[model samples]
Target: MPTDVDLGHHGDRDVAPGLVDLAVNVRAGAPPSWLLARLTGALGRLAAYPDQSSARAAVAARHGRPAGSVLLTAGAAEGFVLLARTLRPRRAVVVHPQFTEPEAALRAAGHEVERVVLAPPFRVGPGLVPEDADLVVVGNPTNPTSVLHPASTLSALCRPGRVVVVDEAFMDAVPGEAESLAGRSDLPGLVVVRSLTKTWGLAGLRVGYLLADPALVARLQQAQPLWPLSAPALVAVEACSAPSAVEESATWARGIVAHREHLAEALAGVPGVDVVPDARGPFLLLRTPVDVRSALRDVGFAVRRGDTFPGLGPEWARVAVRDPDTSDAFVRALRGALGQPAPAGDGGRPVGSVALVGGGPGDPALLTVRGLQLLAAADVVVADRLGPTTVLDGLAPGVKVVDASKTPGGRTVPQEETNARLVSLAREGKRVVRLKGGDPYVFARGWEELAACRAAGVPVEVVPGVTSALGAPAAADVPVTHRELAQEFVVVSGHVPPGDPRSTVDWDALARLNGTLVLLMAVDRLPAISAALVAGGRGGDTPVAVVQQGTLEGQRVLRTTLAAAGDDCARAGVRPPAVVVVGAVAGLVAG
Candidate 1:
């Protein structure tokens, strides 16, 4: 398919036609040596009927459930298909901001499927679920943006006749197995779906299972194809439960949690991206200023967009948590896409071009190559209060330096008035440079100024700055991109400006965006922020970073998030001129 064509979730990650994928959230690592050996050994036996006996026993022992309770299927995808046929619910409800396959499967079964869009940041509240749903399908540590719901929350929906299916496909990636509701027989009508593909990299083997009462298991088993699970899949099930494999999985899980936090922090630092916190799974959801679809491909990267999922709009994307090298590469490409900026007042009439640039966080070093280029070319400069003076000092001795900056409640010119002066000066034909801290497009009000210039017939161009979220991690010596951690990043405002309805903020999408979250001026509402993230289904103990005076000396970086970030900042005596970045990325400071 063409790059512009809608290839769905699988479309963006194709590096070469049908190869090199980063789209699916499976673990980056290859199958274990033991599993490989088992598959090869099993290959000889495939000519005959498969061995369900040992495979079922191995999985049952691993999950600590009876063999009868573990009904193996070809893959997790098949689990959804089987359920759609077995239960055949008249009206099915699928929770949003997660995977689409289950919903699609349900719809395909000729079932009238209703979608329950998760609340912002992505949580299933009481109001969203339909009153009379006979079957409800949901993914835990969901796909796209991996949001893990608590088992307690899952228990609430369990009823005698209603089929409460929780997909624990990503649970193995989380730190503790205690969080999963799988194999719990006490909950009537509880059907848990699990995938070996994600944790063990077994997609080719096509092995997945269903967890429910024996009767319900029998129901789904009846719907399976003859010899549904392959001989290799049976061997994989046995190998997956080996003591060595179990221990190795635990180690990988720990790393995934740590890496997820690190990636979140890195994304939080990038300007024009919003990464929500408490995402415990191995992937994240990012909301980007650049149309990530085109921009990601242009930059030698690919990711899943939110538009395809119910409830998530077009601007959002789902990314896997990759190693440090890939994340950095993605960030660099993202910077390129957002490089298009227009200076507030000056349409660089005859004066050498005036480009407004965001320096990003506190580290001037993180400034994009383009930002540095424009600065070197400027004959005259105007700067904001937060941007470091040292950055201006680096300018040529012959270049004229002007401070057209502002402080809160200043008698100095308002942003609107200051822009007027810039356009007037630029009209005189002098090389004018207006430098701001962070990417200018973000809450910097660069757009408002652009609108003003357009009205005045002034031409303007913008230079991309490395925002504090990305820079804070970089300056703190943390690599936001860790191959073992995050694959996606999201950046959003800390708080909306005055007169805007969302100036207050909505915790749903921000919370549901399962990645790192970077906030600008978000300190005031820390409690609400934490609650929102928690409500959006983020974990409470996720790492956070508060970077004050980023990229500049006296830079104070306090680490905390959501509920506790405000108190931590207060104790550390951190104040404005600070950017708040919350997520696993904070933990990525190099050892």
Candidate 2:
């Protein structure tokens, strides 16, 4: 049909709060102090409508065109809408996978648009466009693809009856503004659109301009509303077009070149990650083996999804170029997402390594990005029953899975055997993953496995998971530590009763503390534990909550007082693999 692409989806949608944004291509820390000062000073003039004469002239002079040839717009986006409304063409074509706004704007204005989807190395040529197409839209240093088409190639698309609109929105980010068509006035029907948003980091300001023949500019202007741009936006347009601002952008463009190269080189080295070749823009297009956007998000980084753009699929992503330090860290996180290990050190360990990953609160989605990566790369996985077992379904067909589950009063995989298996796998030059429930070190005997791997001289790493002790309480809407209720939380093993000789915990001491108590593996011992707390001066009526199968589909919460916790849990058929929270905050959520 009509390409089946989400034309309205942009990179900004890929970003969320608490994430390092690599999705949006806008330069970070933009609108330098000087530009900010100019815009700030213009705020006083907002009482009056904006005057575009000065701004239009400034843009005209910057590109060596007459004032009549420049049309100041609210932003490059508005320019697309203006052109889409003003131009009447029998056949309109848009080149992909570039910016989608042009096609979207045209479609929104009740116009039919065709797409010339380019293959890898996305280089455009005159042959790609149909001769009968009267209107064509393309981007120089295209978005998502980051491929910069030659100026001659774009000019070749222009003819007497055909209109070739070149979007140079990101041209300023390219060193020396290479391959730009803003100054080409002799080419008939050539309209060059330039935006100040990306380089100036003024995306919120909405300032840009289009350069075309005087007649076309006037026609487009007629279609725009009066006072189309704000005063501050008008000031930004004039100030950014100044020669001094141009020179400053040139310097920043050179810096972008360096940062882009650093990011490209590092990404090229990551396994299963393919960086699109010859990236000329400030961002790079990446093709990954699987859709790792969620994994990357889990790791606190946000990347633009490529499937929204025509000619690209879900496996493709767009990441912005950042400083070398940030690029390096991103590369490392990327390696984890792809289940690859860090480069070997001077110690020259074998390619094989062991990673202890926490599966987190029984939900596969709750697993950390690093944990997912290790599991993906593992040749052998030793997993616990309480961990995210469903994740094993996604593993490669060849991966070997071992059940190391421990059942109460039943068959169990010995701790000693689990440790030996990890060491043996690594020694056999296998990438081994020891996956456990919650935090691996939280009463999981993960340290013992680490010790065994180290004793065997096998390189090892740990990817901490969300421990159920805390995750379970939160999932049940029970705050372990509340300012007015409890300021501290104590997590302890409840595998043994209060008076059991094998127990290491001092029940009386724990009872004396007025804080939240989180007990793991304590369902069978709740009677003795509650009695000990009550006998040790703690109130019997203290609130208690048991969260079973926390974060899983079958998760259930049983609420009661400490004195009745044992009977209530027994009657409710509560089981192990649950977190028991004891404190005033436990009863905050009503049954």
Candidate 3:
């Protein structure tokens, strides 16, 4: 009963205003003129209660079932809740990563639901479900996974005491409705739930029906309210189940086959993207090295987040099929988000590109998603010593790793040489990643590389990371600013001694302020800096804390007063890349 997945999350939540929606599986340009006309004509009959006689008979005739076997509801969702409330199965099993409402409804009704999560390729068969499960819920052409289970496989799940509930919500989207069991009345304890929401685009109308044996249908109908379907909803359901509407839906379903293939093929061609094979639904299930949902949103598209499903994680996303033009644009945006170069006009080959990525304080996990994507697609990585160096070990074979680390008082790569290399590699048609430590703009000289790439006419992107200046102090449990102690915090570089001619900082002004002062690259000149601040009308007893190698292994923290900071750090052998915090908040954490 305790699970990490949020069963109530649905695809419509992913859509936002002004975004191209590829999250919901509803067919585009739906509720054709004919169906809309019928619903509009029925609106005048709102004075009368909804009569399910004609709609129920139409659905029964459509599936070759008797009227007693049909139970029309508000929607397929209502049908799921009705069943969850009515069934008293001792062992209930839900096959996922499919639609989540069944599990959610069962749990809401105080039923203990067990999940039979199918693995990748996401195929469903007989032995996958528990033999003792008296109630089984599955989706044909499942949501998120988009893998349609064979009719034979699902039929094999039926037993004398078991209730096999098959959700065929999107089955009408399948050409010829192949693998559909809607008309199979001979199977024992079989319940087929169908919806016109996706293909007919009547989701707002809330029209659907369920077919089962007469006894089971009567039991579920008792759980429903009086005249459950609305007058307009009943009209929509009756119109959608007609023979003419069925033929029209088949034509639309055939078009989806082509559109889905086009989108899947284009996405599969993208590096690091794995498409779930044999996707028979109107959407696709995709897995990538990094979560690209946010990246895709940046380019004006909304996709379903797959983590809400039982067996999927953040790396998975579900994208609906659209027209060829929309699919092409989506693919281009996806390629850009994944750090792959845009296709050139000639032969679709990738063009040269450069990305300035912030690797975040020495911790690979702290790297941004955009940065990780660029690293995965890079042909050349120009890395700094303080960056997440360990992550480079996971790069694919044949990826050229260039050492551009700046060592204090040792051999170093010149800034000019590094800039030149970035432009040169990009000119050679290589995807170049200029990886830096911490926030690239936070004393990392990343603007220089951006300028060089721009001057050389190379397409470039900048991905910001967590800066060590703030991360280090927080890692040591020291807040740079405390509401009662210090209301403001200033971050400054201490590469130059306080009194040096090259120093741009005004030590006197800093000492006059009643706030926290965070110093970076100041370990070597701590004695002079501390003395200068003390001489400038500042208390020698001001609290000071030093954090070294923040957010990584081998991190060290030292707490002292301003007067004793230099002596304490010297005795403790504190080194470069440490952040120094001065003010009352520095002593908030125990020494």
Candidate 4:
């Protein structure tokens, strides 16, 4: 797992080998010690096509189900593809913030995909669907933001002709296996897909399975080619069916849940963050004032961005929880970036327009080229203490620097007044820097300011900066895009629930992705974030880290898994100027 350009590992370069991949959920080592013993016995016959009936029966016995209920797949992603292809429901309503492959497949098959939204804090709305859609699909312990809905809620969505396909690729990490719908038999039109890639580190082998009614399974099976599963993959199935293997997996599940809680608590202690509360899954949601993605990258870490989901945008990201050491290392790298200096202040022009600029965390060095140009053109600097103070130095000696920074303990001006000031300045012909940290597009309240400026007939332009979610993780030397780890990245906020109009982050769609997540402004929400991830079905022990003052001096890192996230942040004393990363990239710190 050492840095290798040949494999396109995170942080790898053509000139220099880089990264011992952690973002990839697969294990660094080959077959586990116990599993190795099974290779000789069950895998010796690689000369011929695998016996499909026996291999499937092995899987059925382990789940205590009939063979008719199971259908082997070439990884769970294909199950969704198959279901999407085979099920010709009148309408396809997919839960937002879940995996997109299903929807994509449905679209390719000429079905209309309707989205159910889960915005911030990743909670579902009061009425999910019209109850009229015939084919519906979702994932438990949803991806990206890691918000897991309860099984009862998922069961309620199941009805005749309404194929509720649940992706449980991560369900093995949950200890109370009883909560999963896959083990149940009564629900009709219920199809469940699971992957051995994440649970047993067999992604390359490409082995997965589906469980549903015999009729549904038969229809799906007919669409796939014969010998859909490779010989080695079938061997893996036979090996995983052992009782001992299941018990060992159980132990790992318990550990993940415990670690997720611990990690969440550690993040909560950090200031200026809103960690999603009640995170029961392995990964938690995070919210910060800065652009989390750029912040992590600038500090030497890489994380997934949450912008692609139906309801989610570019302000969020996802990380994997690995072991303890890498998690801690990630935090230290972030603290350095957060404390990086901002551009210095200069004189004002008093011209008649405004440019709302994002600072991209506190680091002036990490600012986008356009942001720098806008900073130099600013006639007035209206900024808060949270933005890097050094950015003021970028201005001319006598630029009008309006200290909008609020008192730590005294009465502060209302946010409404601040908006009014920007509008007034622009109307008076002054080029203003409505300088907020991170990208103005992400959680900078730019939407409101733009609305206000337009409504007032004041000319306005927005200059975007690197979001801190990416910047902070970069400073920590983590790479979100290891070709082997994942195909997509998601960015999101960690503050309020996705369904809440007041929230800036997309909670629902993030809960459904097969990508990575990066969070911002999530210090206090660590506990809730942790619980949401666990409940969403991300492993409780997924690696997570909080970086305080990334890309600058005084960088402090708190490393832990999702279960222990809360406590670890507390122990490390991480404060407001931190970016939280939850994914396999966090584990790269040690590499």
TM-score leader: 2
How do the residues 1-591 of candidate 3 rate in per-residue lDDT, one tens digit apiece? 456988889988998754677898888655788777887788789998878899989999999999999999877999999999999999999999999999999999999999998998899877788899999999998987888999999999998999999999999989989999999999999999988888888878888889999999999999999998889898888888899999999998999999899999888778899999998989999998899898887766788999999999999999999877568767877887899986563256444888989888888998999999999999999999996899999999999999998889998999989988987898789999989999888999988787566544467788998888888888889999888999998898998898664578999999988999999889999999999999997799999999988888988899999999999999999998899999999889565
| Model 3 whole-model lDDT (C-alpha atoms) | 0.88
lDDT of 1 by residue, 416-516 (tens): 67677666666677667778877788777777555444323344678777766677656666455556565556666765533333355556766666566
- Each model's Cα RMSD: 22.3, 16.3, 18.8, 22.3
Residues 125-187, model 2: lDDT tens digits: 778899999999999989879999989889888899999999999999888888899988999
Per-model TM against the reference:
0.56, 0.60, 0.59, 0.54
Regions of candidate 4 where Cα sits further than 4 Å from its true position: 1-29, 40-43, 340-591
Cα lDDT over the full model 4? 0.68
lDDT of all predictions: 0.71, 0.88, 0.88, 0.68
Decreasing lDDT order of the candidates = 3, 2, 1, 4
* Candidate 2 least-lDDT 10 residues: 343-352
- Evaluate residue 433 in candidate 4 and report its C-alpha lDDT on the 0 to 100 scale: 81
**TM-score rank, highest first?**
2, 3, 1, 4
Badly placed stretches (over 4 Å) of model 1 are: 1-20, 340-591
Which 10 residues in a row give candidate 4 its minimum summed lDDT?
5-14
Q: List the residue pairs that clash in candidate 2.
A: none
The alpha-carbon lDDT assigned to residue 173 of candidate 3 equals 82
